[model samples]
Target: MIVPSSNLTMETELPRMLRAREEAEPGDRFVFHSARARMQHVTPEQLLAMNQQATRAAAELADGRPDVVATACLVAIMAQGPGYHCTAEDDITGALRAEGCSAPVVSSAGALLSGIAALSARKVAILTPYMKPLTKAVADYIEDAGIEVVDAVSLEVPDNLAVARLDPADLREHHRKLDLARADALVLSACVQMPSLPAIQPVEDEVGIPVLSAATATAFRILTELGLPPRVPGVGRLLSGVEEPAA
Candidate 1:
């Protein structure tokens, strides 16, 4: 797994998910590489500019020849517009190919949408560790997928490190504050930096609906694409096939 340099959560959470995979064998492990990007003031122009350099960094990591690489920034790519993950994945794949590496590419944003769709959820409430602007971008991206963003709350944390430092308990508290009355599902937490995996099942049990985070969704998508069982017990019902696994 290769991630953007500014990413602080994937390194920790993704490994935990992979390690917790009940069916994973010893050799089935995950490794990560980070590419530079700015987490503060994430604009579409800035994100695109950062992507050019980030992909180059990924190309360097591709030299080691990972079986697959995941672009971990969700809102950064989604800020470009709807369906941008396809283009982003293509670009990264092309860059790897140019560097004599053939690795499948996946994006966090693409995985989140696919995960939600797989659950057949149409209305959702979201909790994000980003500021209002970035959170809005994420909400818009999901809404573009034909899913209704029933409600959303942003922690307004501007510092990337600060976002990563947030307690999962606090995130669950904020998630509990969101208006989920009409929501068919809850995006429990969307940012990878927010440390959501630990709170997923508990929050779902309390809210009586499915819950997901960027990390869990990405893991689900990557595992499904790899033709492996998507079950990662204790993460959430989403990965355990309580709702539905990705097709």
Candidate 2:
């Protein structure tokens, strides 16, 4: 697991989900590696410039030959353009391969869109800890996936670490205030740095709709790519598909 230096949540949230799974099967173990990212009011240029350095740092961490690498920042890659995750994933994979390390690469932005599509979500409500500009980028990325972002809100937090420290309970409250009548699903939290995993299912139940977070969707994507079952009870129907769990 490799993440942006400014990202303070993925390092903790991802492992929380993995560990919850490991508790069911103690044999599984998880670890992480982080690389620097210019996340403080990150500009498009700054994000692209950081990718090469981030990839290099990830290669150093792959000295142990991990099975896969995940690019944890969603907007950083999405801000580049539509379908940019394909190129970003390729670049990261190529970097790792050049270092004699072969691993599938997953981007949170790509994974979030994939997760939404997998569930056949057509209309969604979104919440983000980003400023209006970055949040629009995320909404556009989702719209590029053919999903309608019917409603959206941003907490307006600019500091990366501060975004990570946002209370999940507060997020749920903010979610409660959103209009969900036309939304088929609620993107309870869009940014990985926003604390959301702990609040998704409850919010879903209360809103009577499927709720998803960046971390939860990323987990779903990683497990799917790993040829493993994605179901982990308590997250939402996305993990446990309408027909069957993601085995």
Candidate 3:
């Protein structure tokens, strides 16, 4: 995981969401390594600056020769506009190649897009911790990928650390407040930094639709890219066996 320096949620939540089942083999567990990029705000300038560290971070992690690398900041890539995750993934792959290593790379932005597609969700609702402008960027970014953002609510938070400090229970209430009648899926955390891993399944049960967070989507994409079964229970509908979208 390559995350923003001020974003404290991914490392904690991802491991919990992806833990090996109790009956698995001794070595069946997945190991995670992370690299941090400097970021304290959700603005365009800060996002661009934070993204500059991706290549170097990829190179550093490639030294371990892991199965996959994930750039786990969603808004950073989305704020770059549509299709930027491809560019970001390419950059990471290039860096790994330069280090004489190869591993599939996934970005939170790309994973979210792919997860939504795998669910075949068209009209979707989103919950974001960004301010209005940044939230709009995320909604537009998703729209460019052929999905419709039927409704979106922003928390209008500026401090990245504060966004991390948000409670998952509060997220459940916010999700309940969304107009979910027509929404095919609910993006519990459009931004990776915001904490929503624990809220995913409960909210889905409450709303009777798929609910997913960027962290879980990235985990599902990583497992898919590695040719592993995506049977992660308790995350959401996406991981319980939603076939990977057609490439």
lDDT tens per residue, model 1, 99-194: 988778878989899889877889999998777888888899899889999999988877666777888877667887799999988987787667
- Against the unseen true structure, what C-alpha lDDT does each candidate score? 0.79, 0.79, 0.87
After superposition, the stretches of candidate 2 with alpha carbons farther than 4 Å from their true spots are: 241-247
Per-model RMSD to reference: 2.4, 2.4, 1.4
Q: For model 2, how does the per-residue alpha-carbon lDDT over 1-247 read when each residue is reduced to its tens digit?
A: 6566777788887877778777765766766555655555556666677665666766775687877788888878778878888888887888788888877888898888877877778999999888888889989988987899999998888877788778888876898667899998998889877888778888888888788888888888887777667766678777763322243
Q: Rank the candidates by lDDT, best first.
A: 3, 2, 1
Question: What would the TM-score be for candidate 2 when compared with the true structure?
Answer: 0.91
* Of 1 and 3, the candidate ranking higher by TM-score: 3
Worst 10 residues of 2 by lDDT: 238-247
Model 3: lDDT to the true structure: 0.87
For model 3, residues 38-64, the per-residue Cα lDDT tens digits are 999888899999999999888889889
lDDT of 1 at 151: 96
A best-first ranking of the candidates according to their TM-score comes to: 3, 2, 1
In model 1, the Cα lDDT at residue 174 comes to: 85
Distance from true position, residue 113, model 2, in Å? 0.8
